[model samples]
Target chain A: MNGSVLSARTLRNLLPALSLLVLLAAIFYLQPRAISYVGFNLMLNLAIPIAFATIAQMCVITVNDLDLSIGTYVGFVACIGATLLSGGIGALPFIKDLQASGALPATLPWIMNTPLAGVLVLLMGIGVYALLGALIHLRNLPSIVVTLGMSFVWLGLSVLVLPVPGGQAPGWIKSLMTLKTPFIPFPIIAAVVIAVAAHILIMKTSYGAVLRGAGGNPKAIERAGWSLLKVKMAMFALAGFFGMLAGLSLVGLTTSGDANIALRYTLLSIAGVILGGGEFVGGRISPIGAVIGAATLTLAGSFLSFMRIPPDWQIGAQGAILIIVLALRTLIDRAEKRR
Target chain B: MNAEPGFIRRLVAKPWLWAYVAAAAVWLVTILFTGGRGGGEVLTAAFTFATFSVIVGIGQLYVVTLGPGNVDLSIPATITLAGAVATKVMDTQDGLILVGLIVALACGVAVGCFNYALIIILRIPPIIATLSSSFLIQSTAIAYGRGIRIKPPAALADFTTAQVLGMPVLALCVIALAAVMEIVLRRTVYGRWVTAIGQNMRAARLAGVNVGRTRFTAYVMSAVFAGLCGYLLSGFSGGSSLSMGEEYLLTSIALVVIGGSSVAGGYSNVPGLWGAALFLFLVVTMLNTYGFGAGLRYLSTGLIIIAVIVAASARKATR
Candidate 1:
């Protein structure tokens, strides 16, 4: 395609994101100076994790499947990451000897002691979530029910891992998310990298085409000699991978892991995905759109908070937005079909 | 002696029999493990769960049978409004109890009507319409009450709490409601129309079922039941608290599912749901007795629902 053709296609794809950006800008303009920066940065930073989760949700919803356990997976990862990075149970039995004289673990390798342990923790988190997805597929369970069950299981695990939600991520991690050397925080950079990678993997690859085809018509794909099971498994694994990244981002921003963090993300992420123009029955998704949707939701939250709406009212607002988005999508789809 | 038993034949023929059996088994296990608590405590808890579950379950059943992807996500909101309205009305005097009930029912009916308008007139999907209505109702209730808890009148409280034959009056109310629903869903022309619509919308419309009116009536009935449940819960709890109806959202769906209603719509079982409600309460009470705590209770319930759905799916696949 020529440059003009590419540009036009890109513009068509970006309509949803652009609309959301306009909304964010409006919100920013309405806010007073003192709190505006706080609101803008807070929303931008918050969007990172939510955007990742929304992308994950979009992938599953694209396949006409719902994973209610994304929130649970996030909680599991956060708790696990916190425990691993914080070290075991205040002081390990062997570490107690070194700590007796107010000394750290001198014999341990630097990699074991540093925040780099987060990589291993992230792997574990992804593994656990993928295993859950596998179980759902193996049992041929409805993704909604299986994930709903997994949420509870993950909650139990979170409680077991971090009973009181006091475990903290390394100081460097928090700084990475909040500190801005120029105009953007490190987490946003990380999100962009992930988003670009995901976009390329989903849009540019044969696997992406096959996945989209499978989503649109799994039976047709199966009859065409494609492995539906493999497609589903891969989709779920991808969702888990994104969920783990979101969890890490959350931990980085919060500086601590709370079991309760996962509770709202499930619904919020679904809302974000839908708002981003990601079709629930599968096919097209833009990472940029997911980010925009997350940004819009975060701005809405900040706006509501600024208006001094009560906590319950915040939930009501989110619910209202979800319904409106769904309604609009249905109407749009009907119109398109009519055309 | 050669003839098969009538009851056995009937039980075998009933589609929901297996659901009832499954629920009964769970209930028995729960009672056994909990060592069959004191009669009064067990009765109160059982009655409370039964009444609450039936009210919510009936609403869900209506939505499930309404077809066109119907499911009332606004049930919790309807219940909340009903509770709030009932409490406010009952605050006047003993003479206003009947008036309170009327007001609660009316509020619920209005919500149902609004839901119908949104879905039918505005052409929104049922799920979307109900969900938005729920949010609107919740926000309105919270803003209006300012999160205040309204105390129920003495007579209303007595109505909820009082027992006949060592059982709470609520249990009898639920049973009566279930019987009425069974007759409404099974014997009436409206019931036949509902089933026909659910089975095939185009065919039903062609056959002169007045599809839109049937759907609207079903939703209205669902909301009224939800309202009644909310009013009873407020009286039972001695007051209406903000977001008190929230817990019923999942529980109602769980009850309907366990009772052999497909979430996709077109089928339901009131008796099965009643049994499931009893089973859920028993399991919850047992879990409490075993000191599993609130977190575990939530986990167990979620897992059970998933397991049931998966099992149902697997069974369907085999068939």
Candidate 2:
């Protein structure tokens, strides 16, 4: 009985990777050229940003909170990186007016033109997220409602920064994202590094255990003399940090962003987390699994295109895939119970 | 906490009252900017637009009142699909209006059933299930309609757009519907069971509340309301468009929260839905009146919502 239960758990853990491989196999079988390294790079490149977003979402789920604002937050960050850090793409109209009126410096300072400024802005965003966590905790407010409202704030900020969709990413960031990695694709390396690093940080560290504990049993953590507030703030801050990374990576690849650029990421990240076997409650999460799940979701879109399905039906197919995956999990759970 | 204040104080203490207060304040601000110019027209427009939001908000409130993690995220897709199917069925014939409405409701019923199956049979979380189902439903709408924008029947359109003494007739009828729903919520056994389940599911189950059936009913009712709103909205707007239901996704959830319903569940505020819906519309109008840019408008809208939530929560805490 114990062995059977262990095997079931192992199967559950491997399901994300298995599904990813299945998708890849399907793509390869349909389009033989996709087996090449160049084709793999093309297919998986977008998965890098999605993986980062998935990790960010995993951080929030680790604390048993949902972030409806993450997509907009990422778009906001991308807008900041592209407009301000990239040295005023086309010079924002309002900023130009302000400068002409001597209300601002004629030229942006050297610091404002650098990646460091973008980093500072992203850190400030993290602070805001931490503050949100504090507010949610102190006020006993639902995270969903708070985050839903915050989504508009982020979107507004994005529009204020970029106004229009066109902007240039900083050259260095673009180069780094498109770096010619030897043999394997750059995206694959980055994804692996992200997955391993996050797995180590969250699944192996002592404080990570405490963070998960905060969600799994807040009263127990409190009894153990841990500050639930601090744990929550840390989780939210981590989410913000990863979300910013996602934005940076996305802008690096696309070289531009708009207010609505990453809106779909909100749903995609949630789906990735669930696809990777993370539960909504109980603080059960897997960093590597989430990364794999993100890759799978990205690949699923590619698989549909390869299948020559209509663009209209592709989104519905993705939804059907999600339902089918979850349904499969249900069957496995039932089988385990029957044992 | 023990001492009872005057009747006015008690009325003020009701959570739903603050939504009305906020709506009035926002309306006052907007009219003040115009020096009362076109204030009546603005209110009339607010009534017309807010009716759709209120219909959806009521459904969302019931679902939210079903406890934590229970929300119907498929509403927007259901609305879009219903509008598309209804318009296609009506085919601009006044005689087939009833058939179109029925077809719309049938779409809702099917969607609601599919959503519940994912939730109960597959044991998927309601949030994920509704979200994924919405994607499927939206795709179906896109495929079936192919972005077609067919006009509604003349009679249906006229009914939706009709006015009486500067007030929307549709709005008045909806208000009547809301009143009936409020009574059902407060006085009916089913309503109490929903509240009980939200308050404590296990306890309610032990007390023989038929939790599954009640939950099924709530989800179905929510989808049905979305369908009705879609049928009406497409007529009011002249035709159904794919993006028509997009804004309602957030508006439905936001109105419920702003209306002073407990997000944690076990509470329902029917009157507050109208107040919140009206407030939301007026806030947008107020921003537009001030000639604020879209960015600033969105920013202030977000800030105002956060402020309201904070204030409402503070009031609840004090009580």
Docking quality level of the chain pair in candidate 1: acceptable
* Per-residue alpha-carbon lDDT of candidate 2 for residues A39-89, written as tens digits (9 for 90 to 100): 878989989989999999999988889998899998998888777667743
Over B124-186, each residue of candidate 1 has an lDDT whose tens digit, in order, gives: 557656766776788777766675676888888888888877777878878888888878888
- Tell me, by TM-score, which candidate is best: 2
Model 2 ranges off by over 4 Å: A88-90, A97-116, B1-5
Q: Give the residue spans of candidate 1 off by over 4 A.
A: A1-15, A32-39, A89-141, A162-165, A170-172, A185-195, A282-286, A305-312, A319-339, B2-6, B9-15, B30-40, B67-69, B120-124
Provide the DockQ value for model 1: 0.36
TM-score of each: 0.85, 0.96
- Tell me how candidate 1 scores on lDDT: 0.72
* Residue A335 lDDT in candidate 2: 85
